[model samples]
Target: MAKPNALHTLAELAQNDTEAAARELGRLQGLRTQAENQLNQLTQYRHEYRERMQAVAAEGMTSGRWHDFSRFLDSLDHAIRQQTTALEKAEADLLAGRSRWQNNKRRVNSFDTLIARADAREEKVAARREQRTNDEYAARLARDNASRLN
Candidate 1:
């Protein structure tokens, strides 16, 4: 069995790794949130722009103005598509980060369990050794007393 100190050191290192993983997971979550917010904003803007264009058309707009609106709406649609793709990628990255954090956490837990078992084993061995020593001392004292009585 490995020494308790060594197991403790490993457990500490595992704990540090778990903390780092958690930080990375947090960063990834933030990025995913930002991407989703940006996507939502772009979608909302596009919807409002379409509504505005319809209102302008109802009020009698020139051909040039109508063409400009059409082009702008198309561009907005493209941007929305791109943003959607970006959001998907961000979500995937967040999932991977979460998985990494969970794995690191499991490693930390395993190391902690090993350390506990090692500690318990050491304590048991020490207790047995103390019992043996006390038994020997008592037996020797009994033998010496017997000799003296002889």
Candidate 2:
């Protein structure tokens, strides 16, 4: 096992790395959310626009007006497709960020465990030394008292 100081240093570095990873994951999550919101808004707008176009058509619209509505709907459909693709990309990025953060966290936890074990070992050794010193002191006192009485 590594020395206590070395273990502590490693744990500190791992903690820093984990923190950076968490920050990046948070940023990725925010981006994914924004993308999803944009995609949803585009989809809703497309649906409402289509409904409006259908209602107008049912009220008897001209061919030129029909072509205009059709073209606008086509553009909306294109935009929706683009937004969907963006959302998918954002989702993928978020997943990758989450994975990175998880890995970093695992590393930090491992380092923490090692440091804890090192500390426990040190404490056990110190306790044993103290017990030995006390026992020797008691034995000497008993011997000295017996010799003085004799």
Candidate 3:
């Protein structure tokens, strides 16, 4: 029946939807984890640099290790900014992925209405066939009785 075929098609769509959603979710989770890790690593880096600077000042090295530390600190700041930008981009990517997942869900849900419509139509056909068969049988019985009477 058409209902069975429709159900099979819907089942296939459901499987594809699930697989796509899982992949998207995984990508979003991974991005979030990476962003959080970077944030943690970037925090307090400057304070550590300052501590190294104070030690260098006390050690009285002819070489300007302090300058190098300051430059290193500046670089770390830039790296943090870059990381923040990357994190924002990742969040946007996650949002986009989520939107796609929602669209897939909607697509699958729409098929339910289609299947219901198909089911109603098939029922009408069945009812009409049954009615016609009953009428034909009644006519045949009436003819047989009339002939016997003759």
**Candidate 1: deviation at residue 79, Å?**
1.0
| Candidate 2 residue 27 C-alpha distance from true site, Å | 1.2
- TM-scores for every candidate against the unseen true structure: 0.90, 0.91, 0.69
TM-score winner among the candidates?
2
TM-score of 1: 0.90
lDDT for model 1, on a 0 to 1 scale? 0.91
Q: After superposition, how far is residue 136 of candidate 2 from its true place, in Å?
A: 1.3
Q: What are the runs in model 1 whose C-alpha is more than 4 Å off?
A: 1-4, 148-150
RMSD of 3: 4.1
Q: What is the lDDT of residue 55 in candidate 3?
A: 88
User: Candidates' lDDT values, in order?
Assistant: 0.91, 0.91, 0.80
- Candidates ranked by TM-score, best first? 2, 1, 3
Cα lDDT of candidate 3 equals 0.80
Candidate 2 lDDT over 1-150, as tens digits, reads 446487788889888988998999999999999999998999999899999999999999999999999999999999999999999999999999999899999999998887778878988998999999999999999999999999
